[model samples]
Target: MSNTPIIEAIKLSKQFTKDGDFVLNSLSLSIPKNKFTAIIGYSGTGKSVFLRQVLGLDRATSGIVRVLGKELHNMEPAELNAFRKNLGVVFQDSALFDDQTVLENVCFPLKEHKRSMSEDKRKAIGSEKLKLSGLNEEHFNKFPEALSGGMKRRVALARALVLEPKILIYDEPTTGLDPVLKQKVDELILTTHKRRSSSTLVVTHDLPSALHFADHIVMLNAGAVLFEGSVSEFLKSSDNLVATFREQGLNKYGKN
Candidate 1:
């Protein structure tokens, strides 16, 4: 993996209301290119908020966020739209359109951004991604409601891959999965990262999953980084917070 950062946040802060405490408090971090980086923390520690800053979905209260070397908050609408084409996001809820078929959901990005492309070409690409995500041909014509939780997650992943993004952002990818299914999803994510060689950032509460699959691990507390290093470093850290977090993770999920 490159030492260069694909996403950089310098003293970034965000507050939803004038009197509210900062959701992200002058947070500064960098995600290395072509690496699988997992951002882990307790709920409400601003993990998801940080994701919004990286995606340019919300403006920061102060500081800056740069993605692919461009200042995200300063980009023009058209420029931001163009830049977003390089990113693919898998939301926590899967966010599949219940009204659309699996194939249609996967092809949605192509329809919106590559409007000039022929329908047949879009379907071809969508079908390829769906298969890569472990879905069979029979699942293509079904709606989201007809699928299982794992199947829905796979479809969401397929849609994310359809755009062939340089950066892949996943929010709580294994939120509701059973242990076996969670492991499968984790393996699928690692396999996809290797196959695409994309820079991946996953915001998750699953410490065991992070420890098992991440090239780099970042821990957050009260919207600031508590620890940032390799999985071994995280595992061996002497910091109280890191130690406590590691212990809790081990107690809950067993050893890595």
Candidate 2:
């Protein structure tokens, strides 16, 4: 990865046609190379859409988005796919196929992108990734339906890392897990960063996890950035909105 920023949005603006209203207006942000950054926002504040814009899945009505110094809107199809390969996303549902065994699921990205690899090699790579996620060999043959929610999320994480992506994006990674599992996921997120040296962008309202794992936090409200700073700076601020956000978020899940 370059020592420069991996991703940045310059004066980005997006509008939705819901009753002729605007959703995102003049929003901008940056993600430093090889660092984990967390994004938090009020409900329906367009955090997901912002993520989509960065992924090139959603277009901004104005402004430019750059990934690795390449403009997102200007990339060709082949270029876009190659560009996207550098990114890995962990969805809220885990997005694991229910019928496929955990091993097969983890191997899907390799099969889809590099069809020439031998099955043995692919399985070996998949198994190694699962092990890195704290999963044992016993999980290989188990189907998604057979695993617990936390286990399935871990399997999804293993799949995300199987390709050794340069950027890893996560959406509410701790949603359904119990306290123990939530901490496990948090640790896994941190470990992934240190082990892979991958830049991470996570969208979550889980304040404690965000504060603990993120080097920087950006808060979105009313479809635009409300605050951006280090976790300690945010916690120390006397702003009412920030205080309320911190209080509600840190308390909702009964965390500090």
Q: Tell me each candidate's TM-score.
A: 0.97, 0.92
* Model 2 steric clash pairs: none
In the range 1-256, model 1's lDDT, one tens digit per residue, is 3566998889989999999999899898888889999999888999998898888899999998899888988889888988898999999889999999999999999998999999999999999999999999999999999998888999999999988999999999998899888988899999999999888999988888888889999998999888989999998899998898888987887673
On TM-score, the candidate that comes out on top is 1
lDDT of 2 by residue, 81-170 (tens): 777878888988999998899999999999988789999999999999999999999879999998898898899999998888888999
Report every candidate's CA lDDT: 0.91, 0.86
10 residues in a row with least lDDT, candidate 1:
247-256
Error of 2 at 6 (Å): 1.3
Off by over 4 Å in 1: none
* Model 2 score (lDDT): 0.86
- Number of the top lDDT candidate: 1
Root mean square deviation (Cα) for candidate 2 = 1.9
Candidate 2, backbone clash total: 0
